[model samples]
Target chain A: MMKWIMGGLISVSVIVGIITGNISEVSNAAIDSGTKAAQLSLALLGTMGLWGGLMRIAEKSGLTNVISKLFRPVAKFLFKGISPDSEAFRAISMNITANLLGLGNAATPLGIDAMKKLEKADNPGETASRNMIMLAVLNTASIQILPTTVAALRLAYGSQTPLDILPAVLLTSLCSVCVGITLVFVFDKKGGRT
Target chain B: MRFSDYIIPVFIAGILIYGLIKKVDIFDEFTVGAKENLIAAFDILPALIALMTCVGMLNASGAADMLCSAVSPFLEKIGFPAECAPLAFLRPISGSGALAVYEQIISENGPDSFAGRVASVLLGASETTFYTIAVYFGAVKAKKTRHALPCSLAADLTAFILSALFVRVFFA
Candidate 1:
């Protein structure tokens, strides 16, 4: 789905640019952006590496597991059919904890771990189950506590008070997750599951 | 503020202290964990390049601008700024694309402006919906995503609306 959209958008953009006489700029952007992606990934390396290491320490010290336990009740309520003693439950609990802290880059590895566990537990084949969809919806809605990236960008751009928008961040994320969870249940009840 | 900036560093420092109390080898574990990140980054490189290329092309072609203008009136009618429609549209599809647009908005409107703050909040609150779906499902080799894409996209829309409304109420 994303592949088709990417290809279609690129093809359409090029044709549109040619017709609009923006062909030169389009070609230049293509070249420049190819380099930009690598640079962006490299930039991500430092932050992700630092946080990844910190999270590992946290994980080994059982900090995240404790946080997981704090969220366990919520997880149990959300993940209705999953057992309390299962690894999948713990993994997903940890994943949700990482996401709530606004440690998105640090959360992916954990999120993937949970996805694989959930896949093994509830989905034996190559299709996403309703539970997996619910998890994805919640993760992607983000519900971040810190809004770190936005603050970082604001500081880089010379905002005197980068965190002033924190209130809005909290409100918006809470609303998004509520709406997303509600819709997921509606869809799940419809057996929109694969 | 600097106070907000300290939160992450402080959290990391606390973790380091805890690791010390727990008698864990911080350096070795850090390297092991960072190595995992590096390997994952390398694997994701190709996908990142392809997605970003399309983002660049779309920006250069003026197509994004056209699309924004097309939706701007409807957005304005609903109380969202016309200027922010692009940010809302691109955010769910591509993180880099949305970031580029977001930085531009902040630069143009001043970081304190309603548009700028709303864009900033939206950036922080929402995830790259399609990209996350693709990566998560791909990792588990989930060929049939069923309701995942639609539900996630719906969530993205909800986030955009809530961000715009909240920023208007709180910042404006």
Candidate 2:
């Protein structure tokens, strides 16, 4: 599946470039993007290290356990089959909390940790579980309480009140998350292979 | 200073204090966790490179622009900013590319303009779905991600539409 997606993307780009007479630009982009990817991964390494460190402290101090307990109702609703006392639950709660705080760096590692836990507890093959799909969808339609990055960009562009769009951001994110969860429920039936 | 500025510092300090009270060997635990996460990051590097290369090629080939223009008319009818068509198309595929386009929009239209506000809300309301899916799925070696892609894109579509609507209601 990953191979097909990657191949499709590459083939489309090349085909389009041929017609558009931008093959040279496409070649350059292919090379540059690889470099960019390496740079991005390097940047993520530092962030992952820092956040992973802090999260470890949180976990050892039972902070994540407390967070998991607080989030049990919501987690149980989203992840029906997963046990609330599991590691996956704790990691998922931590990921959601980090995302809400607009902590992208923290969220990524926690999300990966959650995915690993989910894979371990249930999924034993290459195919994703229903809960795994839900987790990915939830992350994609992330509901952020603070639009910090957008606000910073607005400020850089000289807006008087950068965070003025907060309400709108919140509304849109809510709409997306609701739609995402609804679709997942509709499409991925319970106790069935998805 | 914005209120958000205090969040990270305060949160980090709180974690450190909590760790101390719990008598956790903070540095030892930190390095252990850090090492694990760093390995995870490394594991996903190949996927990231492949996805980004494809995205970069699409952008360079003008395919993204073509699609944006093709969709702009329909978007305008739906009250979506036509200028943000490219952003709506690119946002899911590439985060930094979307940022570059977004910076251009805000600079060209001025951050206070309707398009700028819509773009800001749109950017704030969603994640880079493809990038995130790759990273998370890649970490766990999940090859067959059934329904995740469609579900996420549906969410992105909802976000793109509501971003414009809410921006109008709130600011316009």
Best by TM-score: 1
lDDT accuracy of residue A80 in candidate 2: 63
In candidate 1, which residue pairs get closer than 3 Å at backbone N, Cα or C atoms, i.e. clash? Answer: none
True-structure lDDT of candidate 1: 0.78
DockQ of 1: 0.55
User: lDDT tens string, model 1, A1-194?
Assistant: 66686788799889889988898989998998768767656655665566667777877888777887899889887886889899988889878988876556667878888899999888648777877887888888877777756776677667888888888888888888888888878977787443
- Per-residue CA lDDT of model 2 for A24-70, tens digit only, reads 99999988978876765675577666766877788788886676577
RMSD of each: 3.9, 6.1
Query: Where's the lowest-lDDT run of ten residues in candidate 2 chain B?
Result: B95-104
